[model samples]
Target: MHAKPSYTEAQLIELLKLKNQRAYNYLYDNYSAAIYGVICKVVGDEDEAADVMQEAFIRIWRNIEQYNADKGRLFTWMLNVARNLAIDYIRSAQSRKSSKTESLTESTPLGAPGYTDAIKIDHVGLNAVLDKLTVEQKKIIDMAYFQGYTQEEIAEELDMPLGTVKTRARAALMKLKHLFV
Candidate 1:
């Protein structure tokens, strides 16, 4: 097997700063598959993962100047962008799914993708507030929201009493409301 050409991270950064097409090509060739794998794992949708991969690259290109070598490696910065985009995609997709379910039986025509018009809270900030909750509260909320688990399923999976699960979930939501609103 032939050996692959190697470029140092600093060199790649310099090339990227100059908007070199070859540099962009090299970056994608080396990292796109790995980044896409991460997106797929988080979003669980191949199409959405592909979209997030493209968006992450666009963001990297646009924000190249914002990267700080003193802070960490170039790959670290790229990974952070990819992860954040994937999380945002998952959250947005879930909210859309819920809204669609809610509007399905209404006599009036469903509004055209009104998710963007819904309450606009910063996801990272919300996650921070969630971090402040008790571990059990946080776990239930994550199961219910991120994993799309029903209360019954959560109770069964956690081996907790159904009423206790319901109570904790309600308490978690109330805490989130206070933290977010």
Candidate 2:
């Protein structure tokens, strides 16, 4: 296996700012799998996740100049970019599903093959475990995981400090992990 190149965050930022192709190649080699996994978990489909991940990389490249170290690490910013795109995809899908349901209800041929209520078996267990979490834990976990809100966005919505959001998110993750494992 080829080893990935490591660069300090500052060095990475400088390289990316200069539009160094090597830096971009290093980034994809190292981070694409992690980003793809996150997108897949959020979108719950490999195909859609791949689509979102591609768009996210484009966005990250396009917005490299806007990154600020004082705000957070570059990876965190990139993760948010990927996550926000995934969440946007989810929202857009939900909107389309709702619209489709409306149209289907209005006029659909009798005995349609794809006209049944499908059960999302994965979510049943997830919701059960989520119910066991504390209110704070559940809120933070839901907004971040299911809703794909960034830590900064969560803090802004909850009016809490970024550190506190991180702490709660960590706690919530541990709690959920314990329940599942």
Which residue window of length 10 is worst by lDDT in model 1? 103-112
Looking at model 1, the pairs that clash are none
Q: Kindly provide the TM-score of model 1 when superposed on the true structure, using C-alpha atoms.
A: 0.54
TM-score per model over all chains: 0.54, 0.60
Clashes of 1: 0
* Model 1 segments more than 4 A misplaced: 1-5, 99-181
Best by lDDT: 2
> Could you give candidate 1's per-residue lDDT for residues 101-153 as a string of tens digits?
33222211222122232224634554477467887787786555434557787
Model 2: worst 10 consecutive residues (lDDT sum): 108-117
Per-candidate clashes come to: 0, 0
